[model samples]
Target: MIAASVGSILRSFVDGVIVLNDRHEIIWHDLSEEISLAAKAGLPISELIPSAGRLDFSRYRAHSTVNGVPKYVNYSTFPIQRDGETIAVFSLSTNESKLKDWLHQTIEIKRQALEKEKNQRNERNGTTFSFPDIKGKSLAIKGLIKEAQAIALHNADVLIVGETGTGKELFAQSMHNHSPRAKSPFVAINCAAIPENLLESTLFGTVKGAFTGATDQIGLFEYAKDGTLFLDEINSMPMTLQSKLMRVLQERLVRRVGSNEVTPVECTVISASNEDPEKLIEEGKMRLDLFYRIAHTSIYIPPLRERKEDIRFFTDYFLAYYSKKFSKYVPPFSEELLEVFLAYPWPGNTRELEHLIENVVIRASETDEAIEVDHLPAYMRRKIFADPGYRAIEQKQKETKKRPLTSIFSASHVHYIQQTLEETGWNISKTAKKLGITRQSLQYHIKKHGLGKRD
Candidate 1:
């Protein structure tokens, strides 16, 4: 009589309750009838739950649809303690669709606020106009900036190629800032960062109810309308999405993820790749047709080692900027420190240097008026004093050459070679033509003195 009364009380609740063994196998389900109906043709009592592995069981909350209607479910699993030890599992799932809807709305509001903050930063910093604070006084950088400025006037697509941290995005932003689309949005998206399965929907937005959990929101393409879209690491874009992107470029229109309607966008597309897009194409990681579409104008940014003169300029800029920010009265570089800056081969380029200076200024500001060798990071000090590769190379050059190590000829010659290469994409034929020399002569010189190999 007591068992019958407990069963009658349990059947009155509209929640699903299940008991499981240690292996997560369901031993009994209180709402078996509802579960079976929700499962459609499948047996819900026997079949394992989808995405159950992702659930913590201790505190799991999510939503699923039953018969095309959304159902919010909050599940909690407690270890069944018995005989001073856990013997089984007790699970409780409640319908909380109304609460779930309210929470989702709240989250969306917060997300929008964060997005606005990001956009505001972009505006204040002129992210589309400024270079990546790359420090350099090298002739290569000067000439490259000039060319980028010239190309920015045209509506042609631009492709920036460089190794990672070589500031490809910086060049792209600089190009857009100098271009006709300067005042418009410069939305940047990393092709590799987004999941391959969702890359298409992210690039071209989806309509409400397009798929499960999809809301009416604009995608990257729409967000960048009438402006510039900087696609970073374009080589990592999936091949399937590549076809769709190629079409959008050629047609100037994008179809939303689940809609037939086509939306036209007037925007400039600038793409950057750490790897050679041509090589990616050959390796089946990128599309050749898409490459040609985006490579109407291509710019290559030189690495830090190849533009040694810029190091001092960068260090000075960083020092002053960081000193002001940290409220430090840091003195100008001592002769020894300046030499250290010029000689060290910065593997991480401008970004790394900026971070190092910021650290120094912070430390020095806390206790001293000026930054000294001790305030600098350990890596900077080590590279300055102990790096044998650069020291050995400098020594060898000094021994083999008759001119002073800092001779005007050496500097000017390095500048000339870099300028020629930048103008020609390191192509021997074009560089030779610009320099008024034969291809064989250019090759002879490049081999004679290691000029074009860095590219």
Candidate 2:
């Protein structure tokens, strides 16, 4: 019975088999002809597989050049023992079915299951993602999250400031979910998005006589009773309304439109603005007193361009997320593509990154190959290659065989951009249009290349 079992196992090793001595030399092998038809007993296994001698692990995977193309091979070993002592070892190879390939085949099923379960759980959690759901590891983000968590514990109002698409609302939701009033309604309204006529009533409620077709109803504040009211784009609110809001904060009371009854405020108000509060005040877009009342504890979220590592971090996350979402066998991005991604100013910020991944994954095929350069946008590729600055770095890299330079532009690109900015009087929209890039992308390069305001 033992002899039959051993014979079956040896027959199963039809792909390739080799018995090696303690010296890493082959005592015998029925190896593939492609390896070496001239190979024989007593030859060093390293002669056939150059990496054989370096196999420190019982099983290891490495790439080897085959037909001018690199291919991965897996080598596994089993000890051949005699009288409870190991004498020789049998190494086997299944080059046709690489471990990586096998893992990829099964990942589709596993990923889909995990993604479905996660979505179900998220739906259960009421659509508000907690801090852990926010993916970031940069010190800028780490410090911000720590500070936000501390602020969440209090009942005082918060003011969150960041550029558009920097996830101002995400931070607000995270704060609300972690706060003492997590169970209460986390109401949100965009001041800029709503019409001016309805905006006041939307916040402080309205009576039947307030205006035509108006009914006695609660506004966001009363509806959010003992909960949280997120006021987004606060700077866009009219200056007159800002005074009323400030008064409510100071008195902790709100009165309905066309009614004398004052309702005691029970909800905490968290406001958000895309512009700098001080700058807005200087421009007369926001009231100084309102800024003080609403911004008791404020949080500033750094943009994606400033946090480059976070871009890479989010890239990996979005890749996995979109892959599972689409049920595609999407491979990791090529290094060249990642370099382009890191270099991008991401004018749209994290939202842009998310949309970019979604765009690619939906179009990607089920294959084991990595996402190549052609997979990216044509406009992005053209701009990078056409840029004199990028070409300079490319030339530098070829000469030194080093990684791409962090500075995407050479001195010349900087000078040109600076000249254009100076010509436009530093108007971002005009400069971006002149340069044929988005305003956000131009801003990113301006910050990165130190093209600050001219003296």
Candidate 3:
């Protein structure tokens, strides 16, 4: 009698209410007539709501199609406890299908708003970098590029992992340009740079009268529709915002702030982080579930230091690049200066190298034929000269002037061969050309020395 009375009251109060045992098997329900009783019979709650299995979140939205009709539902699950132990779960669900029309209207309104903004901003729908723009021939970089190119045709979310100055944005842009959506906008946002209070609305969008100061707005997700949205420094995003981001990624829908209506989002997301994502998860700075969702296709860019063979190539490229920009003569680095560059550890990676060369080019005299140590900044000069590796190079150069070439070759032949291979991106022909030997001779040396991929 009591159970019947409670069911009667719940049916009048809620659109539907269901009870489940600890194992999530439905024990009882007061479902609406429109819902499918056949579908709910003797099934786990997860069958109705995917996220209901863990029961981790406080609320969840679920959509189902029944008899050619769509049903949108808002679900709230509560634990029923006795003697301080949860024995069953009670879930209250409300049909939100009525809001479907509202969702569509909201999307159309935002689209019109965004179209106006795009015209005012004069935004272009393309990127600056293609595969060729990624300046590296090292095996690590070449492998990374190959993976990126292969996946660009797909629409999966991409996660780029690397240390700062590893050119994560360059990879993101290249992937966007190579994809089928190349003609669409390539929107990039720095999650760490934006203020947290405004970050949510900026990405997902906002409706008029959503807040006192808020006006109708289209977010980055909408702006990048039919294209790519690059989220840089993702680890720096607040944990609260990360939850909403995960939902958008999973459902491909975004609900503006202060609005219950959800709009469809079709843009591909490419997120990046300079820090190790695992460490960030352990530190509570990033959510593990979000990481898993966004990292469906992962790319890790090796640091410049790890690929030291590319240093000289990048140096020369940057020199020529900045020389043309400044309209100055492209001066070569003195032997002593080049030795210092090779020996010194570049902590700032390619960006640092580029900036340093630009400074050197600007400081060069019209009569200068080569850049010497004096041309470098004071800090770099101090760091390079203080390095013990530079001291060793100086001693080696002095000894090279006195000893026979064969003696030097006998000492560092394998090491020289390995460095050349890496610099040429393991291309046998290029390595041979750089070493002034035939490709067959290079292959024989590689096998002879058992040199493989470098660390």
Candidate 4:
């Protein structure tokens, strides 16, 4: 009778507990009701635990649910040691909502402190990095920066569209740096880098022995939980993976390969694509449904050629960066060199400019102070003399004496209009609406400028 009474007391004290064997399997669970509910809700319990062989007990924390509602729980685990060898692990979990709340508050405070520390470090190191590093004196660039800043505070998916080498990644990083998830991991994966066969497993993960050589592995999506996932070159993502990706975006859940169990992940998705995704959809290379699902909010970064006015700024910035990096004391660009740089059309954009500057900084003689036109790459010198278009444009502007519209219109109006049209897949009505222009005006501009027309 005393033993029966002791058993009853022990059962009453046990609120909710999940016991895992060395291989992180749910061997026993005291909260059967909650587990059933979770299963019914499509959340698999298998993902919540690790395999016995791969168990890292220190990484596991007990969480609690009060009256079956998920309140925070705190659990501690210790290896079951036998003869100085760990045979298994024993864990104890209890209601820890109040403690979790306190810790969360403390963490936030520490996060602010860390941000301050980072800012101080940057300042001390004389780093001029930020959204401002996106060099542009144009109003459009400024507006873009402002809009991106405002959008960063929200937890919305952002789609960045731009030509290759137009700083899409930089913009994505800036958004993450200024976001609520700034303290969390910022994971970036190139959709085009992974093979089509492995893309699904790379993004969503796989279970133990799901395939040959498939040890239990967590995907980029799971690693980025409670953080940000920057999907670069999203247009290159395989069509088969698009459907699965859409499911993940819509359901906020992921199921490992060969496992029906779903793991819930809370992550912000930021995607970038250089190609015209709408066209890709039309061409059947991309799925329209996936496009709409991912493009919640969109921003386009203009190419460097369009933003000629910013060239000098970027050049000076790159020159300074490379000078310090290469431990060279090269002086600023001379008037001739600056003029040549301004005249040259940068096909490879900012990336090319950065490389050119680095080369010059590293190779410049100690006696040579200022960077001159002669120090420039051979191709740049040849291009300047070979192409008469640069001189023709300068002559036309000089004769017209009109504020050079190319500098302003090229960077902001023309590129923005082209991007909007491409996003709408040349649907004039939608493109016009996006551009805040009348359909007739859009048509007139399209014809007058011969935009998107083949030579």
Candidate number that wins on TM-score, 1 or 2 = 2
Provide the clashing-pair count of each candidate structure.
2, 1, 0, 8
The model with the greatest TM-score is: 3
> Each candidate: what lDDT?
0.73, 0.77, 0.81, 0.73
Residue-wise lDDT of candidate 3 within 101-197, one digit each (tens)? Answer: 6898999999999887776444666566778989886888998999999999999999999888889999999998888988888999999899998
- Residue lDDT tens for model 1, 1-455: 77556656665763666667656677766653334456565645334243332334634433445678656565655677667666666556666676677898999999999999878858743473364444468899988888888988998888998877778887888877777787788888898898997888888999989999988878888888788898999988888888999999999898888788998978889999888777798899988899989999999988776776677667777877887786667655543355556667677777778888888776665334334567788877777658765476457557647655555336676678777887778888888798875454455456545675453
Roughly what TM-score does model 1 have, to 2 decimal places?
Answer: 0.54
Question: Which residue pairs in model 3 clash with each other?
Answer: none
Clashes of 3: 0
Instruction: Write down the worst ten-residue block by lDDT for model 1.
Output: 46-55
**Model 2 misplacement above 4 A:** 1-127, 366-368, 379-455
**Candidate 4 to native Cα RMSD, angstroms:** 27.5
Instruction: Residues 94-210, candidate 2: write the lDDT tens digits.
Output: 564354667887898799999998776554333457798777869999999899999999998999999999988888888888988887777889999988888999999999977
lDDT of 1: 0.73
Cα lDDT tens digits, model 4, 67-157, are 6657544444555666876666544445455566789899999999999988875443222235866777766678889999998899999
Candidate 4, superposed: residue stretches over 4 Å from native: 1-135, 366-370, 379-455
Query: What RMSD does each model have against the real structure?
Result: 23.4, 16.9, 28.7, 27.5
